[model samples]
Target: MENPITRPRSVERLVAGQATSDGAGVKLTRVLTQDLQRRLDPFLMLDAFRNENPEDYIGGFPNHPHRGFETVTYMIAGRMRHRDSAGNEGLLGPGGAQWMTAGSGLIHSELPEQEEGLMEGFQLWLNLPAKAKMCAPGYRDIPPPAIPEYVDGAGVRVRVIAGDSGGVAGAVRRPDTEPLFLDLHLPAGAGFGQALPAGHNAFLYVYRGSVIVRGAPVADRHMAILGNDGDGVVLQADGDSRVLLVAGRPLQEPIVQYGPFVMNTAEQIHQAVRDYQAGKFAAAAVQAF
Candidate 1:
Protein backbone atom coordinates (compact mmCIF):
# COMPACT_ATOMS: atom_id res chain seq x y z
CA MET A 1 0.00 0.00 0.00
CA GLU A 2 1.08 3.57 -0.59
CA ASN A 3 2.19 5.68 2.37
CA PRO A 4 -0.65 7.52 4.06
CA ILE A 5 1.08 10.88 4.26
CA THR A 6 0.40 12.86 1.11
CA ARG A 7 1.97 16.14 2.13
CA PRO A 8 4.94 15.05 4.17
CA ARG A 9 6.43 17.72 6.33
CA SER A 10 9.86 18.97 5.41
CA VAL A 11 12.79 19.08 7.76
CA GLU A 12 13.01 22.43 9.47
CA ARG A 13 16.56 21.84 10.61
CA LEU A 14 18.92 19.15 11.77
CA VAL A 15 20.05 19.01 15.36
CA ALA A 16 23.09 17.25 16.69
CA GLY A 17 22.38 16.10 20.21
CA GLN A 18 24.47 17.47 23.05
CA ALA A 19 26.48 15.04 25.13
CA THR A 20 25.68 15.18 28.82
CA SER A 21 25.64 13.15 31.99
CA ASP A 22 22.80 12.77 34.42
CA GLY A 23 21.47 10.41 37.06
CA ALA A 24 24.70 9.94 38.93
CA GLY A 25 27.12 10.29 36.03
CA VAL A 26 25.21 8.17 33.56
CA LYS A 27 26.41 9.45 30.20
CA LEU A 28 23.74 10.33 27.66
CA THR A 29 22.84 12.51 24.75
CA ARG A 30 20.28 15.21 25.39
CA VAL A 31 18.32 15.27 22.15
CA LEU A 32 15.68 17.73 23.33
CA THR A 33 17.03 20.36 25.69
CA GLN A 34 15.63 23.38 27.49
CA ASP A 35 16.12 25.66 24.50
CA LEU A 36 13.83 23.55 22.32
CA GLN A 37 11.12 23.09 24.93
CA ARG A 38 9.04 25.95 23.63
CA ARG A 39 9.45 24.88 20.03
CA LEU A 40 8.19 21.43 20.99
CA ASP A 41 5.40 22.35 23.30
CA PRO A 42 3.84 19.85 25.71
CA PHE A 43 7.22 18.11 25.58
CA LEU A 44 10.19 19.21 27.61
CA MET A 45 13.17 16.93 27.25
CA LEU A 46 14.44 13.75 25.56
CA ASP A 47 17.57 11.97 26.72
CA ALA A 48 19.10 8.97 24.99
CA PHE A 49 21.60 6.74 26.72
CA ARG A 50 23.47 3.71 25.43
CA ASN A 51 26.41 2.26 27.25
CA GLU A 52 28.21 -1.04 27.18
CA ASN A 53 30.42 -0.33 30.15
CA PRO A 54 28.85 -0.86 33.51
CA GLU A 55 30.80 1.99 35.09
CA ASP A 56 29.05 4.48 32.85
CA TYR A 57 25.54 3.78 34.14
CA ILE A 58 26.19 2.05 37.43
CA GLY A 59 25.57 5.01 39.67
CA GLY A 60 21.98 5.33 38.40
CA PHE A 61 19.53 8.01 39.50
CA PRO A 62 19.06 8.28 43.20
CA ASN A 63 16.01 9.61 44.97
CA HIS A 64 15.08 12.84 43.22
CA PRO A 65 12.05 15.04 43.33
CA HIS A 66 9.86 16.09 40.43
CA ARG A 67 6.71 18.10 40.01
CA GLY A 68 4.29 19.50 37.40
CA PHE A 69 5.28 17.07 34.67
CA GLU A 70 5.33 13.50 33.45
CA THR A 71 8.20 11.13 32.65
CA VAL A 72 8.20 8.31 30.11
CA THR A 73 11.16 5.98 30.05
CA TYR A 74 11.49 3.48 27.18
CA MET A 75 13.98 0.72 27.54
CA ILE A 76 15.50 -0.65 24.35
CA ALA A 77 17.85 -3.15 25.96
CA GLY A 78 18.29 -3.00 29.69
CA ARG A 79 16.76 -3.53 33.09
CA MET A 80 15.88 -0.64 35.36
CA ARG A 81 14.34 -0.71 38.79
CA HIS A 82 12.02 2.16 39.58
CA ARG A 83 10.86 3.02 43.11
CA ASP A 84 9.03 6.09 44.21
CA SER A 85 7.83 7.60 47.49
CA ALA A 86 4.27 6.60 46.63
CA GLY A 87 5.28 2.94 47.07
CA ASN A 88 5.36 2.20 43.36
CA GLU A 89 8.01 -0.27 42.32
CA GLY A 90 8.57 -1.96 38.98
CA LEU A 91 11.23 -3.60 36.90
CA LEU A 92 11.43 -2.23 33.35
CA GLY A 93 13.21 -4.66 31.06
CA PRO A 94 13.96 -4.79 27.33
CA GLY A 95 11.31 -3.14 25.16
CA GLY A 96 9.37 -2.08 28.24
CA ALA A 97 8.30 1.36 29.40
CA GLN A 98 7.40 3.20 32.59
CA TRP A 99 5.20 6.27 32.70
CA MET A 100 5.07 8.44 35.80
CA THR A 101 3.15 11.61 36.41
CA ALA A 102 4.69 13.85 39.03
CA GLY A 103 1.50 15.72 39.42
CA SER A 104 1.89 17.56 42.73
CA GLY A 105 5.24 15.94 43.62
CA LEU A 106 7.20 12.75 44.27
CA ILE A 107 10.68 11.44 44.95
CA HIS A 108 11.88 8.52 42.89
CA SER A 109 14.95 6.48 42.03
CA GLU A 110 15.93 4.61 38.82
CA LEU A 111 18.78 2.21 39.27
CA PRO A 112 20.33 -0.16 36.81
CA GLU A 113 19.64 -3.84 37.32
CA GLN A 114 22.37 -5.24 35.12
CA GLU A 115 26.09 -5.64 35.72
CA GLU A 116 27.35 -5.55 32.16
CA GLY A 117 26.46 -5.62 28.44
CA LEU A 118 24.50 -3.07 26.45
CA MET A 119 22.17 -0.64 28.16
CA GLU A 120 20.08 1.56 25.93
CA GLY A 121 17.01 3.69 26.45
CA PHE A 122 15.33 7.03 26.14
CA GLN A 123 13.55 9.26 28.67
CA LEU A 124 11.04 11.90 27.70
CA TRP A 125 9.50 14.64 29.82
CA LEU A 126 5.93 15.65 29.04
CA ASN A 127 4.53 18.76 30.61
CA LEU A 128 1.20 18.77 32.40
CA PRO A 129 -1.43 21.41 31.82
CA ALA A 130 -1.98 24.08 34.44
CA LYS A 131 -5.24 22.55 35.63
CA ALA A 132 -3.79 19.06 36.10
CA LYS A 133 -0.49 20.16 37.55
CA MET A 134 -1.54 19.52 41.12
CA CYS A 135 -3.58 16.40 40.58
CA ALA A 136 -2.62 13.15 42.30
CA PRO A 137 0.60 11.51 41.12
CA GLY A 138 0.31 8.37 39.00
CA TYR A 139 2.51 5.55 37.66
CA ARG A 140 2.28 2.71 35.17
CA ASP A 141 4.76 0.07 34.13
CA ILE A 142 4.07 -1.31 30.67
CA PRO A 143 5.83 -4.49 29.76
CA PRO A 144 7.01 -5.16 26.20
CA PRO A 145 4.07 -7.34 25.32
CA ALA A 146 1.55 -4.70 26.38
CA ILE A 147 2.80 -2.05 23.95
CA PRO A 148 0.94 -2.20 20.63
CA GLU A 149 2.86 -2.75 17.41
CA TYR A 150 2.04 -2.44 13.71
CA VAL A 151 3.92 -4.06 10.86
CA ASP A 152 3.41 -3.00 7.28
CA GLY A 153 3.96 -5.01 4.11
CA ALA A 154 7.28 -3.34 3.48
CA GLY A 155 8.69 -4.71 6.74
CA VAL A 156 8.26 -1.44 8.52
CA ARG A 157 7.57 -2.10 12.19
CA VAL A 158 6.18 0.56 14.45
CA ARG A 159 5.73 0.45 18.18
CA VAL A 160 2.94 2.74 19.24
CA ILE A 161 4.00 3.95 22.65
CA ALA A 162 1.57 6.71 23.58
CA GLY A 163 -0.96 7.27 20.80
CA ASP A 164 -2.90 5.58 18.05
CA SER A 165 -0.91 4.44 15.01
CA GLY A 166 -2.15 2.40 12.08
CA GLY A 167 -5.36 1.68 14.02
CA VAL A 168 -3.44 0.37 17.05
CA ALA A 169 -3.75 2.05 20.45
CA GLY A 170 -0.63 2.50 22.48
CA ALA A 171 -0.10 1.34 26.04
CA VAL A 172 -0.80 4.73 27.57
CA ARG A 173 -2.54 7.94 26.57
CA ARG A 174 -2.96 11.39 28.11
CA PRO A 175 -5.78 13.90 27.84
CA ASP A 176 -4.51 17.40 27.21
CA THR A 177 -1.32 16.70 25.34
CA GLU A 178 -2.56 13.97 23.02
CA PRO A 179 1.07 13.06 22.52
CA LEU A 180 2.17 10.58 19.88
CA PHE A 181 5.25 8.54 20.63
CA LEU A 182 6.28 5.98 18.03
CA ASP A 183 9.41 3.93 17.56
CA LEU A 184 9.97 2.86 13.98
CA HIS A 185 12.18 0.11 12.66
CA LEU A 186 12.65 0.21 8.92
CA PRO A 187 14.53 -2.15 6.70
CA ALA A 188 16.92 -0.91 4.04
CA GLY A 189 15.16 1.18 1.39
CA ALA A 190 11.84 0.88 3.17
CA GLY A 191 9.55 3.79 3.83
CA PHE A 192 7.00 4.60 6.53
CA GLY A 193 4.53 7.38 6.97
CA GLN A 194 2.28 8.67 9.72
CA ALA A 195 -0.44 11.29 9.63
CA LEU A 196 0.14 14.01 12.17
CA PRO A 197 -2.11 16.90 12.98
CA ALA A 198 -0.92 20.03 11.25
CA GLY A 199 -0.92 21.98 14.49
CA HIS A 200 1.15 19.52 16.44
CA ASN A 201 4.89 19.99 16.97
CA ALA A 202 6.88 17.04 15.72
CA PHE A 203 10.43 15.74 15.42
CA LEU A 204 12.30 12.57 14.60
CA TYR A 205 15.53 11.25 16.09
CA VAL A 206 17.51 8.61 14.27
CA TYR A 207 19.21 6.23 16.67
CA ARG A 208 20.47 3.60 14.24
CA GLY A 209 21.54 3.87 10.62
CA SER A 210 19.92 6.83 8.85
CA VAL A 211 16.71 8.03 7.26
CA ILE A 212 15.60 10.65 4.76
CA VAL A 213 12.84 13.17 5.34
CA ARG A 214 11.90 15.36 2.43
CA GLY A 215 15.22 14.45 0.87
CA ALA A 216 17.05 15.68 3.96
CA PRO A 217 19.36 13.17 5.56
CA VAL A 218 19.06 12.53 9.30
CA ALA A 219 22.03 10.56 10.46
CA ASP A 220 22.37 8.36 13.50
CA ARG A 221 22.25 10.27 16.76
CA HIS A 222 20.82 13.29 15.00
CA MET A 223 17.38 14.90 15.22
CA ALA A 224 15.24 16.39 12.52
CA ILE A 225 12.66 18.95 13.61
CA LEU A 226 9.69 18.85 11.25
CA GLY A 227 8.21 21.97 9.78
CA ASN A 228 4.59 22.86 10.54
CA ASP A 229 3.52 23.34 6.93
CA GLY A 230 2.56 19.72 6.31
CA ASP A 231 -0.02 17.40 7.79
CA GLY A 232 2.22 14.40 8.33
CA VAL A 233 5.65 12.88 7.64
CA VAL A 234 7.17 10.26 5.36
CA LEU A 235 10.53 8.73 6.18
CA GLN A 236 12.71 6.63 3.86
CA ALA A 237 15.44 4.56 5.37
CA ASP A 238 18.87 4.63 3.77
CA GLY A 239 19.62 1.40 5.57
CA ASP A 240 18.29 -0.70 8.37
CA SER A 241 17.32 2.05 10.75
CA ARG A 242 15.53 2.73 13.99
CA VAL A 243 14.03 6.11 14.83
CA LEU A 244 11.77 7.79 17.36
CA LEU A 245 8.93 10.01 16.22
CA VAL A 246 7.39 12.28 18.85
CA ALA A 247 4.64 14.82 18.41
CA GLY A 248 2.26 16.62 20.73
CA ARG A 249 -0.20 19.47 20.75
CA PRO A 250 1.18 22.67 22.18
CA LEU A 251 0.14 23.69 25.66
CA GLN A 252 0.90 27.29 24.61
CA GLU A 253 1.41 28.25 28.25
CA PRO A 254 4.23 29.82 30.14
CA ILE A 255 7.00 27.39 31.05
CA VAL A 256 9.10 27.97 34.10
CA GLN A 257 11.54 25.26 34.96
CA TYR A 258 14.08 24.83 37.72
CA GLY A 259 16.11 21.67 37.65
CA PRO A 260 13.58 18.82 37.73
CA PHE A 261 10.56 20.99 38.50
CA VAL A 262 8.40 22.54 35.76
CA MET A 263 5.66 25.08 36.28
CA ASN A 264 3.87 27.86 34.47
CA THR A 265 5.26 30.69 36.53
CA ALA A 266 8.28 31.65 38.59
CA GLU A 267 6.26 31.66 41.78
CA GLN A 268 4.97 28.18 41.07
CA ILE A 269 8.52 26.96 40.54
CA HIS A 270 9.56 28.52 43.81
CA GLN A 271 6.61 26.91 45.53
CA ALA A 272 7.64 23.53 44.16
CA VAL A 273 11.12 24.00 45.53
CA ARG A 274 9.82 25.03 48.88
CA ASP A 275 7.41 22.14 48.97
CA TYR A 276 10.08 19.61 48.10
CA GLN A 277 12.45 20.99 50.74
CA ALA A 278 9.70 21.10 53.31
CA GLY A 279 8.94 17.39 52.95
CA LYS A 280 5.48 18.08 51.58
CA PHE A 281 5.97 16.53 48.15
CA ALA A 282 5.07 13.06 49.33
CA ALA A 283 2.38 14.04 51.78
CA ALA A 284 -0.34 12.04 50.04
CA ALA A 285 -0.10 8.40 49.10
CA VAL A 286 -0.43 7.55 45.43
CA GLN A 287 -1.76 4.48 43.63
CA ALA A 288 0.68 1.58 43.34
CA PHE A 289 2.09 0.50 40.00
Candidate 2:
Protein backbone atom coordinates (compact mmCIF):
# COMPACT_ATOMS: atom_id res chain seq x y z
CA MET A 1 0.00 0.00 0.00
CA GLU A 2 1.24 3.54 -0.81
CA ASN A 3 1.80 5.60 2.26
CA PRO A 4 -0.39 8.68 2.08
CA ILE A 5 1.99 10.73 4.20
CA THR A 6 5.02 10.29 1.92
CA ARG A 7 4.01 12.43 -1.04
CA PRO A 8 7.61 12.68 -2.38
CA ARG A 9 6.60 15.94 -4.05
CA SER A 10 6.25 19.21 -2.23
CA VAL A 11 6.07 22.90 -3.03
CA GLU A 12 9.55 24.30 -3.52
CA ARG A 13 8.57 27.81 -4.54
CA LEU A 14 5.51 29.94 -5.13
CA VAL A 15 5.04 32.86 -7.48
CA ALA A 16 2.08 35.13 -8.10
CA GLY A 17 2.11 35.79 -11.82
CA GLN A 18 2.48 39.40 -12.86
CA ALA A 19 -0.16 41.45 -14.66
CA THR A 20 0.60 41.88 -18.35
CA SER A 21 -0.94 42.48 -21.74
CA ASP A 22 -0.02 41.04 -25.11
CA GLY A 23 -1.23 40.65 -28.68
CA ALA A 24 -3.07 43.86 -29.48
CA GLY A 25 -4.19 44.95 -26.01
CA VAL A 26 -5.43 41.57 -24.76
CA LYS A 27 -5.20 41.43 -20.97
CA LEU A 28 -3.84 38.36 -19.17
CA THR A 29 -1.58 37.09 -16.41
CA ARG A 30 2.03 36.08 -17.17
CA VAL A 31 3.05 33.09 -15.06
CA LEU A 32 6.58 32.27 -16.21
CA THR A 33 9.53 34.58 -16.61
CA GLN A 34 12.34 34.73 -19.16
CA ASP A 35 14.77 35.80 -16.47
CA LEU A 36 16.24 34.30 -13.27
CA GLN A 37 13.01 32.76 -12.03
CA ARG A 38 12.81 30.55 -15.12
CA ARG A 39 12.93 27.23 -13.32
CA LEU A 40 10.46 25.67 -15.70
CA ASP A 41 12.70 25.01 -18.67
CA PRO A 42 11.40 23.91 -22.10
CA PHE A 43 8.12 25.42 -20.96
CA LEU A 44 8.59 29.12 -21.61
CA MET A 45 5.49 31.04 -20.58
CA LEU A 46 1.92 30.51 -19.32
CA ASP A 47 -0.71 33.20 -19.90
CA ALA A 48 -4.05 32.83 -18.10
CA PHE A 49 -6.90 35.08 -19.16
CA ARG A 50 -10.29 35.19 -17.48
CA ASN A 51 -12.55 38.17 -17.68
CA GLU A 52 -16.29 38.67 -17.30
CA ASN A 53 -16.21 42.07 -18.98
CA PRO A 54 -16.34 41.74 -22.75
CA GLU A 55 -14.31 44.90 -23.26
CA ASP A 56 -11.43 43.37 -21.32
CA TYR A 57 -10.89 40.63 -23.94
CA ILE A 58 -12.75 41.57 -27.12
CA GLY A 59 -9.60 42.98 -28.66
CA GLY A 60 -8.09 39.45 -28.72
CA PHE A 61 -4.80 38.57 -30.36
CA PRO A 62 -4.19 40.09 -33.73
CA ASN A 63 -1.99 38.66 -36.48
CA HIS A 64 1.40 37.68 -35.11
CA PRO A 65 4.36 35.55 -36.10
CA HIS A 66 6.19 32.89 -34.11
CA ARG A 67 9.17 30.61 -34.67
CA GLY A 68 11.49 28.10 -32.96
CA PHE A 69 8.79 27.20 -30.44
CA GLU A 70 5.26 25.88 -30.00
CA THR A 71 2.11 27.41 -28.54
CA VAL A 72 -0.70 25.48 -26.84
CA THR A 73 -4.00 27.30 -26.49
CA TYR A 74 -6.60 25.66 -24.26
CA MET A 75 -10.03 27.19 -24.03
CA ILE A 76 -12.06 26.72 -20.90
CA ALA A 77 -14.94 29.02 -21.81
CA GLY A 78 -16.02 31.26 -24.75
CA ARG A 79 -15.10 30.85 -28.39
CA MET A 80 -12.03 31.98 -30.33
CA ARG A 81 -11.55 32.20 -34.08
CA HIS A 82 -8.09 31.14 -35.27
CA ARG A 83 -6.69 32.01 -38.68
CA ASP A 84 -3.20 31.36 -39.85
CA SER A 85 -1.29 32.47 -42.88
CA ALA A 86 -1.14 28.78 -43.79
CA GLY A 87 -4.83 29.10 -44.69
CA ASN A 88 -5.86 27.13 -41.63
CA GLU A 89 -8.96 28.33 -39.81
CA GLY A 90 -11.05 27.06 -36.95
CA LEU A 91 -13.51 28.15 -34.31
CA LEU A 92 -12.22 26.94 -30.95
CA GLY A 93 -15.16 26.66 -28.60
CA PRO A 94 -15.30 25.82 -24.94
CA GLY A 95 -13.10 22.89 -23.82
CA GLY A 96 -11.15 22.99 -27.06
CA ALA A 97 -7.39 23.00 -27.58
CA GLN A 98 -4.93 23.95 -30.31
CA TRP A 99 -1.29 22.88 -30.33
CA MET A 100 0.76 24.80 -32.87
CA THR A 101 4.40 24.10 -33.58
CA ALA A 102 5.96 27.18 -35.19
CA GLY A 103 8.95 25.32 -36.41
CA SER A 104 10.58 27.45 -39.09
CA GLY A 105 7.84 30.11 -38.85
CA LEU A 106 4.15 30.94 -39.05
CA ILE A 107 1.78 33.90 -38.79
CA HIS A 108 -1.52 33.51 -36.98
CA SER A 109 -4.25 35.37 -35.11
CA GLU A 110 -6.77 34.47 -32.41
CA LEU A 111 -9.77 36.75 -32.28
CA PRO A 112 -12.88 36.58 -30.16
CA GLU A 113 -15.69 34.68 -31.86
CA GLN A 114 -18.31 36.62 -29.96
CA GLU A 115 -18.70 40.24 -28.95
CA GLU A 116 -19.89 39.64 -25.41
CA GLY A 117 -19.79 37.22 -22.42
CA LEU A 118 -16.93 35.69 -20.45
CA MET A 119 -13.64 34.57 -22.06
CA GLU A 120 -11.31 32.31 -20.16
CA GLY A 121 -8.35 30.36 -21.48
CA PHE A 122 -4.64 29.68 -21.29
CA GLN A 123 -1.82 29.98 -23.83
CA LEU A 124 1.34 28.06 -22.96
CA TRP A 125 4.60 28.42 -24.84
CA LEU A 126 6.87 25.38 -25.13
CA ASN A 127 10.45 25.77 -26.30
CA LEU A 128 11.76 23.70 -29.16
CA PRO A 129 15.19 22.13 -29.08
CA ALA A 130 17.93 23.49 -31.35
CA LYS A 131 17.66 20.60 -33.79
CA ALA A 132 13.87 20.59 -34.04
CA LYS A 133 13.50 24.37 -33.96
CA MET A 134 13.69 24.63 -37.74
CA CYS A 135 11.61 21.57 -38.54
CA ALA A 136 8.45 21.74 -40.62
CA PRO A 137 5.65 23.61 -38.89
CA GLY A 138 2.47 21.74 -37.98
CA TYR A 139 -0.68 22.07 -35.90
CA ARG A 140 -3.23 19.90 -34.09
CA ASP A 141 -6.68 20.99 -33.00
CA ILE A 142 -8.60 18.98 -30.39
CA PRO A 143 -12.26 19.71 -29.91
CA PRO A 144 -14.13 19.32 -26.63
CA PRO A 145 -15.58 15.96 -27.56
CA ALA A 146 -12.22 14.66 -28.72
CA ILE A 147 -10.60 15.23 -25.32
CA PRO A 148 -11.07 12.38 -22.88
CA GLU A 149 -12.39 12.82 -19.37
CA TYR A 150 -12.30 10.69 -16.26
CA VAL A 151 -14.19 10.74 -12.99
CA ASP A 152 -13.68 8.81 -9.79
CA GLY A 153 -16.32 7.62 -7.36
CA ALA A 154 -15.28 10.48 -5.08
CA GLY A 155 -16.54 13.01 -7.64
CA VAL A 156 -13.03 14.16 -8.52
CA ARG A 157 -12.87 14.95 -12.20
CA VAL A 158 -9.84 15.16 -14.47
CA ARG A 159 -9.46 16.32 -18.05
CA VAL A 160 -6.25 15.19 -19.68
CA ILE A 161 -4.98 17.44 -22.47
CA ALA A 162 -1.44 16.17 -23.15
CA GLY A 163 -0.75 13.28 -20.82
CA ASP A 164 -2.09 10.12 -19.28
CA SER A 165 -4.02 9.69 -16.06
CA GLY A 166 -5.42 6.44 -14.64
CA GLY A 167 -4.72 4.68 -17.97
CA VAL A 168 -6.63 7.30 -19.99
CA ALA A 169 -4.51 9.43 -22.34
CA GLY A 170 -4.79 12.97 -23.71
CA ALA A 171 -5.24 14.08 -27.32
CA VAL A 172 -1.93 15.84 -27.89
CA ARG A 173 0.57 13.33 -29.27
CA ARG A 174 4.35 13.29 -29.78
CA PRO A 175 5.07 16.93 -28.96
CA ASP A 176 8.70 18.07 -29.06
CA THR A 177 8.51 18.52 -25.35
CA GLU A 178 6.85 15.54 -23.76
CA PRO A 179 4.29 17.44 -21.73
CA LEU A 180 1.74 16.44 -19.15
CA PHE A 181 -1.13 18.93 -19.08
CA LEU A 182 -4.08 18.16 -16.87
CA ASP A 183 -7.11 20.03 -15.56
CA LEU A 184 -8.26 18.84 -12.17
CA HIS A 185 -11.47 19.59 -10.32
CA LEU A 186 -11.92 18.41 -6.76
CA PRO A 187 -15.27 18.80 -5.13
CA ALA A 188 -15.59 19.98 -1.57
CA GLY A 189 -13.89 17.66 0.95
CA ALA A 190 -12.35 15.66 -1.87
CA GLY A 191 -8.74 14.63 -2.43
CA PHE A 192 -6.81 13.75 -5.58
CA GLY A 193 -3.42 12.24 -6.30
CA GLN A 194 -1.46 10.91 -9.26
CA ALA A 195 1.97 9.63 -10.21
CA LEU A 196 4.15 11.96 -12.26
CA PRO A 197 6.90 11.25 -14.74
CA ALA A 198 10.25 10.77 -13.14
CA GLY A 199 12.69 13.71 -13.12
CA HIS A 200 10.24 15.98 -14.90
CA ASN A 201 9.88 19.65 -14.04
CA ALA A 202 6.36 20.12 -12.75
CA PHE A 203 4.16 22.86 -11.35
CA LEU A 204 0.61 23.50 -10.27
CA TYR A 205 -1.50 26.56 -10.96
CA VAL A 206 -4.55 27.03 -8.79
CA TYR A 207 -7.14 29.10 -10.58
CA ARG A 208 -10.23 28.46 -8.43
CA GLY A 209 -10.77 27.87 -4.74
CA SER A 210 -8.05 26.75 -2.29
CA VAL A 211 -6.09 23.51 -2.08
CA ILE A 212 -3.32 21.77 -0.20
CA VAL A 213 -0.33 20.68 -2.24
CA ARG A 214 1.83 18.18 -0.46
CA GLY A 215 1.74 19.90 2.92
CA ALA A 216 1.42 23.52 1.81
CA PRO A 217 -1.61 25.68 1.15
CA VAL A 218 -2.10 27.24 -2.30
CA ALA A 219 -4.69 29.87 -2.99
CA ASP A 220 -6.25 30.82 -6.29
CA ARG A 221 -4.22 32.70 -8.90
CA HIS A 222 -0.93 31.35 -7.57
CA MET A 223 1.63 28.91 -9.01
CA ALA A 224 3.47 26.27 -7.03
CA ILE A 225 6.78 24.89 -8.28
CA LEU A 226 7.25 21.30 -7.22
CA GLY A 227 10.47 19.67 -6.21
CA ASN A 228 12.07 17.35 -8.76
CA ASP A 229 12.43 14.50 -6.31
CA GLY A 230 8.71 13.76 -6.35
CA ASP A 231 7.43 10.85 -8.40
CA GLY A 232 3.80 11.86 -7.93
CA VAL A 233 1.52 14.73 -6.95
CA VAL A 234 -1.05 15.00 -4.17
CA LEU A 235 -3.79 17.52 -3.52
CA GLN A 236 -6.69 18.05 -1.13
CA ALA A 237 -9.48 20.49 -1.81
CA ASP A 238 -10.09 23.11 0.85
CA GLY A 239 -13.22 24.01 -1.01
CA ASP A 240 -14.30 23.35 -4.59
CA SER A 241 -10.77 23.65 -5.90
CA ARG A 242 -9.70 23.74 -9.53
CA VAL A 243 -6.14 23.53 -10.82
CA LEU A 244 -3.96 22.82 -13.82
CA LEU A 245 -0.93 20.58 -13.52
CA VAL A 246 1.85 20.75 -16.11
CA ALA A 247 5.13 18.90 -16.34
CA GLY A 248 7.85 18.54 -18.97
CA ARG A 249 11.43 17.43 -19.38
CA PRO A 250 13.87 20.33 -19.40
CA LEU A 251 15.89 20.86 -22.60
CA GLN A 252 18.83 22.49 -20.78
CA GLU A 253 19.86 24.40 -23.88
CA PRO A 254 20.67 28.01 -24.57
CA ILE A 255 17.48 30.05 -24.99
CA VAL A 256 17.72 33.30 -26.93
CA GLN A 257 14.39 35.02 -27.17
CA TYR A 258 13.37 38.19 -28.97
CA GLY A 259 9.71 39.05 -29.29
CA PRO A 260 8.04 36.10 -31.05
CA PHE A 261 11.32 34.53 -32.05
CA VAL A 262 13.14 32.02 -29.84
CA MET A 263 16.51 30.62 -30.83
CA ASN A 264 19.78 29.40 -29.40
CA THR A 265 21.94 32.29 -30.45
CA ALA A 266 21.60 36.04 -30.92
CA GLU A 267 22.57 35.68 -34.58
CA GLN A 268 19.65 33.32 -35.13
CA ILE A 269 17.28 35.76 -33.46
CA HIS A 270 18.35 38.58 -35.80
CA GLN A 271 18.10 36.26 -38.79
CA ALA A 272 14.52 35.34 -37.85
CA VAL A 273 13.54 39.02 -37.84
CA ARG A 274 15.31 39.57 -41.13
CA ASP A 275 13.65 36.50 -42.63
CA TYR A 276 10.21 37.68 -41.55
CA GLN A 277 10.81 41.07 -43.11
CA ALA A 278 12.24 39.49 -46.27
CA GLY A 279 9.07 37.40 -46.69
CA LYS A 280 10.90 34.15 -46.09
CA PHE A 281 8.35 33.33 -43.41
CA ALA A 282 5.69 33.22 -46.11
CA ALA A 283 6.86 29.74 -47.00
CA ALA A 284 4.87 28.48 -44.04
CA ALA A 285 1.77 30.19 -45.41
CA VAL A 286 0.67 27.20 -47.42
CA GLN A 287 -2.84 27.36 -48.85
CA ALA A 288 -4.25 24.63 -46.63
CA PHE A 289 -7.30 25.38 -44.54
Maximum-TM-score candidate: 1
Error of 1 at 155 (Å): 1.0
Q: RMSD to native for every prediction? A: 1.2, 2.4
Candidate 2's residue-wise lDDT over 9-113, tens digit each?
Answer: 999988888898888778899987676225788789888999888878988899889999989999989999998878788889999999888989999999998
Q: Which tens-of-lDDT digit does each residue in 1-289 have in candidate 1? A: 2358878999998988899999899999999999999999989999999999999999999999999999999999989999988888999999999999999999999999999989999999999999989889999999999999989888999999998888889888899999999999999999888899979999999999999998999999999999998989999999999999999999999999999999999999999999998999767467533
Spell out the clash pairs found in candidate 1. Answer: none
Error of 1 at 62 (Å): 0.4
lDDT of each: 0.92, 0.84
Which one is best on lDDT?
Answer: 1
